[model samples]
Target: MIKITFIEHNGTQHEVEAQEGSTVMEAAVMNGVPGIEASCGGACACATCHVYVDPAWKETTGSPEVMEEDMLDLAYEIRDESRLSCQLRVTPAFNGLVVRVPEFQA
Candidate 1:
């Protein structure tokens, strides 16, 4: 299992253990982490699952694909570290990944 931490805009934090191969968005929505709307249900079509990866974890997460990159442009409060959680697959290497949700997404 991998541990994922979600920090909400209001400073609330939630941590969940996720299975490998599952997307971060899936885990968040399943765990009821307040900020992920997941309006597209992991299809990468909606930017509602947007989250900012902690800078320290960015190197491990890497950059988004062209399609995900394009979709992120429609997200509110886009940042260099912003990513669509649906596109982020969990892995043992990402066991302690941390993400912050934007205020608008909540």
Candidate 2:
């Protein structure tokens, strides 16, 4: 399992473990983490699962693909660190990854 930490805009933190191959969004939803709506259910069609990869883990999380980037364009308060959690597949390297959820999502 891969462990990931999610920090809400208000600074609430949720740490959860998820099976490898599962998306970060799935982990958040399964663990009842607040702020991730996952409206498209990991389909990469909605921006509600958006998160900001911690600068230290940004390289490890990698960059989003064209499709995800396009979708992220619709996310609220998009930033250079912005990413759609549904597109981030979990891996052993993500054991301590940290992400920040926006206050509001589109």
Candidate 3:
């Protein structure tokens, strides 16, 4: 299992263990972590699953593709670390990964 920590805008932290092939959005939704609506599922059409990758793990999390970057433009409070959770696949390498939910999403 891959361990990931999701911190809400209000500082509520949800630590979840997910399958290697699953996406971060899947882990959050499956674990009932608040703040990730994932309105468009993992289609990359909506940016409701926006999150900020911890700066220390940014390289490990990888960068977004063109499609994801485009969609993120419509997300609220876009930042250098901003990423759509649906676009992030979980892996053993992501153990202890940290993501922060913005105050609002797209």
For each candidate in the order shown, give its overall lDDT on alpha carbons: 0.94, 0.94, 0.94
Least lDDT summed over 10 consecutive residues: which range in candidate 2? 1-10
TM-score of 3: 0.98
C-alpha root-mean-square deviation, each candidate: 1.1, 0.6, 0.6
Please give the clash total of every predicted structure, in order. 0, 0, 0
The lDDT, on a scale of 0 to 1, for candidate 1 is 0.94
Model 1 bad stretches (over 4 Å): none
Reference-based TM-score, model 2: 0.97
lDDT of 3: 0.94
CA shift of 105, model 1, Å:
2.9
Q: State the displacement of the C-alpha of residue 76, model 3, in Å, after optimal TM-score superposition.
A: 0.5
6-102: candidate 3 lDDT, tens digit per residue: 9999999999998999999999999999889999988999999999999999999999999999999999999999999999988888999999999
Each model's TM-score?
A: 0.97, 0.97, 0.98
Candidate 3 ranges beyond 4 A from true positions: none
User: lDDT by residue for model 1 over 2-45, one digit each (tens)?
Assistant: 89999999999999989999999999998999979999899989
